[model samples]
Target: MSTESATHLRDESGPFFGEFGGRFMPESLIAALDEISAVYEEAKADPTFAAELAELHRTYTGRPSIITEAPRFGEYAGGARIILKREDLNHTGSHKINNVLGQALLARRLGKTRLIAETGAGQHGVATATAAALFGMSCVVYMGEVDTERQALNVARMRLLGAEVISVTTGTRTLKDALNEAFRDWVANVSDTHYVLGTVAGPHPFPVMVRDFHKIIGEEARAQVLELTGALPDAVVACVGGGSNAIGIFHAFLDDPDVRLYGYEAAGDGVETLRHAATITKGRPGVLHGSRSFMLQDADGQTLDSHSISAGLDYPGVGPEHAWLSSIGRATYLPITDAEAMNAFRILCQTEGIIPAIESAHALAGAIELGRELGPDATILVSLSGRGDKDVETAGRYFGVLDEAALAASALEQNALDANELTDGEAEAGELDHDAALTAAARQALDEASSRVDDLSAATGNGVER
Candidate 1:
């Protein structure tokens, strides 16, 4: 085996990739990350941890997630044979549970009683809550108020799973703000609480720890794809938010110099529009959330609000290792627009009967481009990172696929009926008969119209007839 494969197959001892993976945190949290890292190192070596996690993988998270060949989707991509690692099919509906379960287990080993985390689109929050519930630990999720509104159902799901949901109302009230709140909470309650950082970003041990937890994705994909095709894929593609899912699959193929790795970032409106979250493509070197990496900041060193149809990819900074890899040209970073992602989202749902998360659709979009380039002979593997349940409403509204005109017509119809009722008021005045009935009927009609609008909104790109 090559050195990289040997390092990954064995227990992750000393950081394998580079200096990008280490423990750099506040002095207060340093000892905790150190302890956690040490325990994780030992756990990897111990057959018990391996067996336990493997059991959970088979029984709970459904390990060996299928690698699906998308023949129809591939047809548009230059006839390149495209395959997808269906991480979207994992328990809790995403690859996030992989890392959370490992961390929760580590928390048990460390005797931590409480679990805390920050969420962007609520996928990580839901995954963390699921692990906390399974482990019977107190779980607190900090979500930006804006994200809370956008992903309200996921917030409710987390609460129903026995997690305390805190809506952060700080700067911009988004993922970064929620992360700031989580860091503050960690600093304050470091003794009893373990901060479950979601991605392969943050500081030091986090990138390494989370990457180790998720490396199973690549491990399985590498073996499965080789078995199915008798050769490694030409390229591996994944979306980069905090870079966990991308790193998860990319790490295993690092030794395969013939295998090209591509990471897709969300280009909210467009890169030049100054409204995108394509950090690796357009950002400058800076430190934002504890590590030095490419960050979207203004001339004054102030971080800007990142835009994306998918809330998960709307981050101002990318993972440090991704930054290092980009610098060394080990991987290529590409940006996908909201329109292209939405189109891919519709295509996946229509073609494969799968509705991919908007974030994951970016990778699908990249696959479309790669398919065109590689042609029919090559094979590409894309990580379907998460599900699309959280983005249906947003996608509906963005594409003008919702029945706004029908809703407006219904509203106008109700208003006309109300006007006729007022003009034909022929009942008792003091007893408030006709006017009251008219007002109640108008409100009811308007509510029904609004309901139609909501229904239309929910139906967008769902492959449902209008």
Candidate 2:
């Protein structure tokens, strides 16, 4: 990367990054945003602020998250070494806590008694709620109605953290809608509420402030990787959803000329179709969620709805820094479809005994492709951004694991409809008892499955084995 371009990426002097980010918001919220910017800048200069945040990260948020080698998963990646920066093991099970803790401390400094936030997959909401509880502040989280159903587990976690969750139903009924509502709430309650912006998008200081909070991810991972492999990774990969986690892990390696950065976006179905959240891959320069960035907009400049099985990536616009990164060729952004992401999600679960967030799975999918392209001698570091505990239901439904009993019963019923399934020619010749054969259809199916097992001596032949 050119020094000029890298400066453009790492520059924090203003709201805009190259041609991407700027303060675009309603007149009513400008003053509040400016206040946040001022407070954040002051906090940035204070050593006491850094010390306090580091202490909180160490004691509460689980700082210096570990990295683990995914050797088993590496086999699927063409034997490339897959080292995972395990942000999933953090307290709230994601990198979101890093920013939330910082912002909550800022909120306290600003004399705010409440925190207003928006969430997509609910990790940010859970994190913000946790911070609110820690600081004795009231919390309210705006979430899309669709997300509330899909990520119900995180919803429960937020409520248990003593936060009120409002389900926004307007617009696309996803992350963007929730953000719109959160902004409106901030406009109304700016005096006593701090809108803990979740990702590296939104207006002005939000993108900068959020990224600063998360830079520790890359800093620690960089040193850890150096110690583990005695070299910087050949490539660092992460999922880009509004660009927080991606920028978090990608920041430290920006100056390393040989270290490549790859960010995977959510391709709900396929990038060829409209059902995708590949902002940097499919979008053009535009404004959404208070920042001018790469956005999925129609020719008329209307922001289009984004789709993704991973709720966190379901946004039409991405952070301005990502747009800048893509424009300057400092980073590569690609689309990973739902099927591809879920396949990697399951692969990590079964192979490495680690279940990653669906959002992070996109990064894993991209890393697999890069591993094949870069060869086995290469090293790839992936940001396993969050655990899959909240995604158990979604994964179960996606893999059909939850419907196993129903699937088996349906297969048996469908098999019974085919008389030829019972015998070769006796049934056709009317030499067999149809009633008996039909009655034994389910058992026959079970027996067929059991016969394939080498240790069937302990099998009950009813889809069960001793």
Quick one: best lDDT, which candidate? 2
Give residue 394's lDDT in candidate 2 (0 to 100): 85
TM-score against truth, every candidate: 0.86, 0.86
Can you write out model 1's per-residue Cα lDDT over 1-466, one digit (the tens) per residue?
A: 4676444433343342443444446798788777877888788889998888888889999998999999888877778888999999999889999999999988988899999999999999999999999999999999999999989889999999999999999898989999999999999998999999999878767878888889999999999999999999999999998899999999899768799999999998999898789999999877777777788999998998898878899888888778777887879999999988888887787778888999999999999998888888999999999988777767656654656556556666776676666667554564356556656676776677577676766656455211
Off by over 4 Å in 2: 1-9, 403-466
| lDDT scores of the candidates, listed in order | 0.85, 0.89
Candidate 1's TM-score:
0.86
Residue 35 displacement (Å), model 1: 1.8
